[model samples]
Target: MTNETEVDVIDPVAQIESYTKKDFQLTRLPYDFLYGLRNNKFQYSQMQVVMADKASKEGVKSFKQLYKDYLATYHSDEQMLAVNYTEFDGQPFQLACGSYICHDDIALLNSNGIVEEICNHPVLPCVRLVNIDDNTEKLIIKYRKGYKWREITVDKEILASASKITSLAKYGIAVNSENAKGLVKYLTDIEDLNYNEIEEKNSVSRLGWINNHGFSPYVDGLVFDGEENFRTLFNSVKIKGQIENWIEIIKPIRAEKNICSRIMLAASFASVLVNPCDCLPFFVHLWGGTEAGKTVALMLATSVWADPTMGAYIRTFNSTAVAQELTASFVNSLPLVYDELQILKDKKSFDDMIYKLCEGIGRDRGAKNGGVQKIATWKNCILTSGEFPISSEKSGGGAVNRIIEIDCKDKKIFTNPSELVSEIKQNYGCAGAIFVKWLQQGDNIETVKHLRKDFYKKLVADSDVTDKQAMSASLILTADKLINEIFFNDDILLSVSEMQSILTTRASVDQNRRCYEFINDFVAVNYNKFNPEKDGYNGEIYGTVIEDRIYFIKSKFDAVLQENGFNAKAFLSWAVENKVAFTAEGRSSLTKRICGKVCRCVCVLSVEETAEDQLLNNEDLPFD
Candidate 1:
């Protein structure tokens, strides 16, 4: 053991140098570190020795000294940054920087901790204006160079490590190694000194209750987590003129010969009714010729709740289905209004969208960081306008219950659409809140349920629409009844007789039946694609025609069905059940000679005759 009183000194500089091989000055080393060098107990490593020696000898106690003298050593005193820009546009812009710099952005840089440079792999300023709530990581960051405070709430993972902290340069914050160490120290210091808990919730925008309370976006306790996209949406849902003004102008239109105006208005309120009535989403697709003014009807519907601008609440279908699903989740209880369904990516996908949108839950998606993304859910009616029917013969019968296709035929919906648009643009978003207020009132929900049930019964008894269709239509009718009674003094009641046109049933939505017809038509036109029995035909052989049966090459048949957007396995199974197809005795498909080649095939009755012919020849009828 070394002497307790005597100094057991070894070379301190040599110990640090041997451990790290870095030269460090000895101006600021404590005497204790030199004494502990004998037992390898030097607490200050070589890196710390170098950092302590090099740390600004001019100790910056206040933010002012640290910002101007120390921070400027790394970057120019006159730091120019981009000013006054939201991460996105068309929303209320609140810059997070304590003050936005109108001219060139001189970042006191770290003066207010708003326009900061954070430390990362390269030790650069990755984040700025680090606003935190208490000890929690509910961070709001400042961007732009102007005096305005446009703040965006960021995730805490931004502060995790070198790579994560570096990604904050996306907000136009200048990042370099200047004053990085001092700024990093300042961030750690402020975290302990300042502790104010701000109320930031991930509240989604909707028509009904916000934050589990009644429907007031403003005066609500929770500050939305800086998703100003929803701000753009909610800002448009402002109350302009009086509710009486809206009713005065729209009541006459509701009474017009065209049932479209009434249906559109009812469907607008029907979105909020979906949750209250406890039903899945349904579509009210208004379709017609180009001159039928379906867009005008859509505008009227959108104006009932928000700004009637074309791209505002009423958007085009010129986007991906993923975008639409996110939008649906965003506007949970509001009308998911889409204009020009003709511009959708494809009709087949749009046909599938009805079932998807009605399901009220988004598909589980994988995140880039090898994690699951949040699945979105919503219950609301979808309003669509297009030149042709949204759902066609290719659609399944179940989709029929999800969609109520309105045919405007050749009739023009409005005499003066331009004038109506002008009036609505000024006086909108007045009635949606009023309608919701009545629904949210104490004990009024039972009335809505009873009224919906009564409407459902009447619709089923009177119209040929299916049970699901009748149930969906009843919600619309219930909304229409309630809104008329509450808002318009029951003056603009939508007639059940007029609305029944939407529920009027005619042809089948059965995809299997349509596939059968499509196959018959396809075979007639594509006979040259088939092989002949003579073995002298010149072309690609899709199948072999033998007597009354066509033996299709299995691969070619599946490819054809897939190309035309039909499930091959599903169609073949349906065909077998209906006796339109013939399978091998012990197998699902035929192993037969097709086009003079022994291969797997799907045997189907020719367009001219069916295999039901064999059942009649059996002579096994009990009645006989």
Candidate 2:
């Protein structure tokens, strides 16, 4: 036998004389090791093995656990052990046969300590599981990867798989074949321990009210359960800087009387009011030339609720339509925002985005197993910005009510926008949650409802506001009033007269008239694509110009219009009625022999004739 000093779990060096007095040996090695570890007289997990003989093997059962074999060796049954197998009452001290370790035990080498002594295995770094999500169907393990902790949700059956064991290496829990069964046993044994301490609230994937409970993920009686990679979605809706700092930087923005700044901020708040106010989703588009501060204004609006930096609360137009829908659903009642509309390659894609983002529901997709996947839906205002207008002349007339196009004006909205960007990024995520909390307090939600109604009534009665336009406008104004009262303490309020400039009338958004204007613009830009001037040119011909009349090829004209989401036949009808397109003998189109073939074309007045006609119709028209 050899002498080995046992290290105390707490005071490692304090008990040097006590170990020297004992003269402990290798007999009953399993029992002594287990007892010493359980009693805190030794450290097993971090111990170094200095000596070995005959190659130690792992023991599944304790030496004292062979009770039946001990009795069988003797003729008669005895009080406990027929032969004394362990040091303490023929049993391992402080070792309970219950499902798991007792709460009161101060143990280093768990599970009898026999395995470590026999196999020379270090004690497993026991995992500290946090019951974050309340799903009994699965087990969620929260483990430390160095200093920071991460979560992995897994089914109970797959807890000790090879992949899972490898995944746990980063979590600091070292496991091998000899100790794999021990780790699994430890986890399953403690699954129900301290059951009452675990919070039993369900997890949520969206931002707004989870149920009648009225708890947002931001407020955190609930855990965020978005896709594992989308942790930023939940993290974005958090408070970083103090609320006072947010208010201080944001107050002057409201006071500036800048339409884009004020309206974008209000729109951020208005998304939450969509449910309470019983209104539909709409778009607030801020567009202008370069350096007009469109994206900066978007960031200011986004800061009202979240981090205003790109890819944080604000997304770009680089994502696909399906990805955007998923993002919308995740944001839920929060304002769904995007910057740099120019990332989208074409006009048709933007038009399609308009309908999809405003639809309030995601596409019904099928699951891999069959049936349908969970349908994602939301109520939110969509905020967007770009170098050009969101809605062009060819946009759907219905899209008019669904969107509010604000020109960023001729000059830059902010002379020094980068300074504002730096401030907002650091001092955001304060107001959005507070605004929601303020509304939920007492009769405040009801108050907002009434404000929306009052504004809508006044907007339609006094001004030429369409119902949809009035609805969106009223919500924004009401939001403006709420935030002003909460922060600015009632500064120079944005009046209805000033706000009315943003609403587009039915005449302006009329699809037919827009289509007619689109054709005129198209012809002017592509004049070189037409003929006569460039005869025998090998470039693809769009039309043939004969004197003042340009005959656009019917196929080419229809295809281009359709590609741009315009109704070509409807545009032709309106163009003929307006005398912009010339028809032969009251027919819809004319047949002309061009390029050595009989071809059908829409013979239209040149751009000069169309402009001169418009000048003649207006008495107040100015001549340049």
Instruction: Report the number of the highest-lDDT candidate.
Output: 2
- Which ranges of candidate 2 are over 4 A from the true structure? 1-138, 142-151, 154-202, 415-419, 462-465, 519-557, 569-624
Candidate 1: worst-modelled 10 consecutive residues by lDDT:
82-91
Best by TM-score: 1
Q: For model 1, what is the alpha-carbon lDDT of residue 72? A: 37
Question: TM-score of every model?
Answer: 0.68, 0.67
Q: List where candidate 1 sits over 4 angstroms from the true fold.
A: 1-152, 156-167, 172-211, 216-222, 368-370, 397-401, 461-464, 490-500, 504-507, 526-556, 590-624
lDDT values, one for every candidate: 0.63, 0.65
- Clashes in predicted model 1: 16
**Candidate 1 per-residue lDDT over residues 1-624, each given as its tens digit:** 223233335454443333321222222122223323323323323323333333323331221223223323433323312221111112232222222221122233444434443432111112223222122344555434344435455555554443454455566444434643433343333333233322234332333444346554432443444345666766676677878888887877876846777887888898887887788888999999997889999999988888999777777888777878888887888889888987875677866888888888999999877799868888888999999888876677777668988888968999888889899888888898777777777888788999999988887774566777877788888888877787776466766666566673533455665676677667778787764554567777777777778777888888887878678888878878777788988776788775557888888877543432333332321111
Q: How many clashes does the backbone of model 2 have?
A: 0
lDDT of 2 at 336: 89
